[model samples]
Target chain A: MRLLTALGQDIRFQFRHGFYYAYLVLTILYILSLRLLPESLVYPALIIILFTDICALGFFFIGAIVLLERGQNLTQSLFVTPLRLHEYLLAKILSFLLLSIVSAFLIMLGGSVGGQDLLWFIFGAIFSALIYTLFGLVFAARARHVNDYFVKSLGIGLLISLPILAYLGLFDTPLFYIFPTRATLILLDTLGGDYALSEKLYSVANLLIWFTILSAWVYQRFDRYVRHPV
Target chain B: MIRVTKLHFAYGSNSKDTLNGLNFHIDSGEVFGFLGPSGAGKSTTQKILIGILNNYRGTVFVNGLDLQKLTSDFYESIGVAFETPNLYTKFTALENLDFFAQFYAGETRNPNELLEAVGLKDAANTRVSDFSKGMKVRLNFCRSLLNNPKLIFLDEPTAGLDPVNLRKMETLILAEKARGNTICITTHDMHVADTLCDRVAFIVDGEVSLIDSPRQLKLQHGERFVDVEYRDGDSLKTKSIPMDKLGSNDTFQDILKNHYMETIHSREASLEDVFVKTTGRSLQ
Candidate 1:
């Protein structure tokens, strides 16, 4: 019940602060861009677009939200309440997930993309957004300002995107599986077409494992750097 | 309602402790103030009591619960107004209060009533970003009371208020105290400490030097004399008379009978004076 209340407030906060409106414009642009692509290129382009923009929107947006809250000293007021750290984090992730899922669904619909496994697409969207959101939180905790967050996140962003090279078959390696984005790309590829059952299981297992690891790490960093900074 | 013994804290491993062996207790329904300058461990101590920073090497008990063992429910009974106005600028004043009111499991005060009490009723629908510093301070104060908390922690509660608003905040604080709430205020404003606190602790160098009622502190530190300013034939003159025998003193009687007395004042030390004398440091 407490989590739901916090989530409601978070959603209201985002709505009032223009986050939903900004995403509305961005999502429409993505749908239009997808429609302009050739029918043969639409599926791959949509996958790439979803993986880069919608799934990763949480990464950039959560950083901005956290940093803005920090700058305004809102965290001090927030953590003082009965709301636990995990609930706060979950609300943030879920709120951003709402935006990501809505945008991804609209883009897919507008592009007339179909014949994909809906469950895999949902899982792909959720897990990918969760991973990136948690990753963003880790950096946001350490960032002193919005500019600092972006500069540091840009470096982390490039490192995480190295899996794209492996996805494009330019630098394929088993080592790429270590990055959560690798699992995200594999899961998102299911949206374009069916894959081997073993590959799907591997992708699911990889994302689940990464989610567990990142959850613990994100909790620790947020507790240390954001909640109880020395 | 609150107790601390040998409370010690430091920001980092290599740094010296910011709070050093502080001991104090606030009875329920008492208004306690932590009076100190910046970096004097006043805020550090309040943070510890409020469960914000818990890595302290001492024992703290609030409302009979150990600070370390406290859970989220502990917050339900406590409200804190931070030194800075840490509110959402994007939300309207009423919206901010309503948003925070949802966090409490128990009953909460009406947001409109709180806004009205803080003189923000007319601006309830205004976004906080449009609020001046004083207005934000008032709104921040209103949020702290939404839970109708039993124990309240106010940090520099009068930092940005004009005279009129400052008096309003003070009256509201006294009203809360009248309702039997224990309020712990941390501030360097001696006037506020004097006016609001039942007892204040003069904290300097991370240690409390004195803890007593403002009236008692003044009596103990102030000179036992009264100053009289009288107008002579051509000029004004002043005389200091010991307060102990003022009625029997011939000079005081003569001044009142022979000269037009302009003004008379008891030489009672202000809280600022007592703070300086006790802590050996200015509030600045």
Candidate 2:
């Protein structure tokens, strides 16, 4: 109850005029990009196209929001409230999860990507958002200042992207499956419901593991690390 | 009431303890002042008391409940106004109050009434970004009362305000004191400590050098003499005389009966001078 009440205000604040505009502009831009994508993705290079475009963009946006909060000192304010540490970690995942799902689904729908595959795309985008949002929180918490945050985040992003981007030339078979980008491929190919038992098991297990590790770090270290100097 | 015994807390594995063997108790309804220069364990002590900083080696009891034993319920009994105004700039002052007030299990006072007390009622509808530093400080003052707390923690509560607003803040603090609220104020400002604290602890270099009531501490260290000023043949002259010898001193009698007295004032130490005397460090 304490956590919900504290987070409610922050969630609502994010939906206010200035914040809402930013969210809207990002959503519109994403949808427009989908509309303008090469039709080749709808057929042949679907997995490559999905991993590179929507999933990547959504993760980048999540990082941007976390970095903004760090810059504005909202994270510090949230730290001082009578909230348990895990509550914030959970709230961020849940809030961003819901928002990105709605965002990804709308863009896929408006761009004429239809049927059950669209639902899977939304689910994939949500998983990717959760993973990267946690990643961004860890980085933002570790950063000493806002400018340092951006420079370091961009560096981290480039390093994480290296192998993923190399998939275009380095592999004859689908390489996205080794990464959580597998979810994005499944969604774009509309293969979520069609995937085998072992594949489903792998996706679920990896998601759970990442979430557990990130949440534990949040509980143990995030509070002390981000407490502003008095 | 708050009690801390042998409290020890450090930032990291390689750092020394910020709070080491700290022992103190604040009785119910007492206004306690923590006076220290920058980084002198003032904030560390306040954070420990407010449940913000944890993992410390200590036995801390507040309102008869152990600090570690209690959970979110501990926050319900106390209010805090940090030195920096951490308000939602996008929201109106009233909206900010309304949002935070919902988190408390305790009955909250009306936001408007508290804002009116601090002279921000007319500005309630205005966005917090539009408020000046003093206005924001007033808003923070209103925030501390919204929960109707039994204990209040105010850090540098009057640091940036002008003299007029500073007096208003002092009066508002007195009003809280009148209502039997135990307040723990942290500041490097000596005047705020002298005028408001019932008892103040002079913290210098992570240690408490002296702790006593402002008046009592002033009297204990003040000179036992009075400086008498009078105009003698168009020249202003002054004489320092021991207060005990005034009953038999002819010069004192002559001054009282003969020449017009320019000024008569008791020579007593300010709390700042007392702090310097005890700690050998300025309150800055």
Candidate 3:
């Protein structure tokens, strides 16, 4: 019940702060960009867009949100309430995930893509958003300002995006599978259909493993840098 | 409702301890003030008690619960107003209060009533970004009471208020005290400490030098005399007479009979004077 209430406030806060409006504009642009592409190119383009941008919205947004709250010293007021740290983190993660899911759904619909595997698409969106958002929070916890967060996150973001080289066929190496984005790309590829069940299972298991690892790292960093800052 | 013994805290392994062997206890419904200058461990103690900064070598019990073992439910019974206004700038006064009110398990105060009590009813719909510093401080105070908490922690609650608003804040604090709520105030504002606190602990260099009522402190440190200002012929003159034998003092009687008395006042030390004398450091 407390988590739901916190989530409600977080969503309202995001809405009032223009997160919804920003996504509305961005999603429409993504759809328009995809519409201009040739029919043969639409599926691959859509997957690339979803993997690189839509699913990663939380990664960029959560940093701004957390840093803004920190700058205002709102965390001190917030943590003093009955809300636990995990609840607070889940509320943030879920709120941003809602935005990412809605944007991905609209983009796919407007792109005239049909026969897509809706279940896998959503699973990919959820896992990708969850991992990236948690990843962003780790940096956000240690950053003193939004600019600092972005500067630090950019380096980490580029390192994770190395998997894109293999996806684009520019560099194909088995080591690319070590990055969580490889699992995200594989799951998101299911939207194009014809993906084997074994690969889907591998991606699901891989993402879950990555999620568990990131969750632990996020919890420790947030507890140290945010909850008990010196 | 709060007790501390041998409380010691340091920011880092190499740094000096910020709080050193502090000992104090506040009774239920008592208004306890931690009076000290900036960097004197006043806020550090409050944070430790409120479960914000937990690394300390001491035992602190708030409502019989250990500080180190506190759970989320521990916050249900307490409210804290930070020294700075730490509110959402985009949120309306009402929205901010309503948002926080949902976090508690039990009954909470109505947002509108809390705003009205703090003279913020007219601006309830206004975003906090538009509020003046004093208004934000008032709204922050209102947020602290939303839980109807049994114990309240107010840090420099009246730092940015006009005289009228400051008095209103003081009156509201006193009213809360009357309602059997224990309040711990951390501030260097001596007037506030003198006006609201039942007992104040004078802290300096991480050590508490004195703990007593403001009235008692003044009496103990002040001279037993009264200063009289009188107009004599062409100029105003002043005289000091011992308060013990004023009625029997011939000079005081002669001044009242022969000259037009302008003003008379008892010579009592202010809280600031007592703080300086006791702590050997000014509040500035």
Top of the candidates by lDDT: 3
Question: How good is the docking of model 3, by CAPRI class?
Answer: high
- In model 3, chain B matches the true chain B with a TM-score of 0.98
Query: Hey, what RMSD does candidate 3 come out at?
Result: 1.3
Q: Which candidate is the best by TM-score?
A: 3
Best candidate per DockQ, number? 3
lDDT of 1: 0.89
A42-143 in candidate 1: lDDT tens per residue?
Answer: 888887888888889888888889988888888889888888889988999899898898888888788788654777767877999988888899898878
Please count the clashing residue pairs in each candidate, in the order shown: 0, 0, 0
List the lowest-lDDT window of 10 residues for candidate 2 chain B.
Answer: B11-20
Model 3 per-residue lDDT tens digits across residues B1-284: 88899999999664889989999899999999999999999998898998889889989999999988999899999999999999989889999998999999999999999899999999999999999999999999999999999999999999989999999999999999999999999988988999999999999989989999999999999999999999999998999999997898999999988999999999889999999887789998
Query: How would the candidate models be sorted by DockQ, starting from the highest?
Result: 3, 1, 2
**How far in Å is the alpha carbon of B97 misplaced in model 2?**
1.8
Which parts of model 3 are misplaced by more than 4 Å? none
RMSD of every candidate to native, in Å, equals 1.5, 3.3, 1.3
Q: Compose the digit string of candidate 2's lDDT tens values, residues B1-284.
A: 98978888786663877776777889999999999898899988888787777677879988888877757666676888877777778889999898778767768899988888888889999999899999998898787777789999998999789889899999999999999999999999888998999999887666677889999999988998899999888999999888887888888898888888999888788898898899888866
Cα lDDT, model 1, residue B100: 88
Reference A-B contact fraction recovered by candidate 1? 0.79
TM-score list, all predictions: 0.97, 0.88, 0.98
Model 2 error, position B269 (Å): 1.8
- All candidates in order of lDDT, best leading: 3, 1, 2
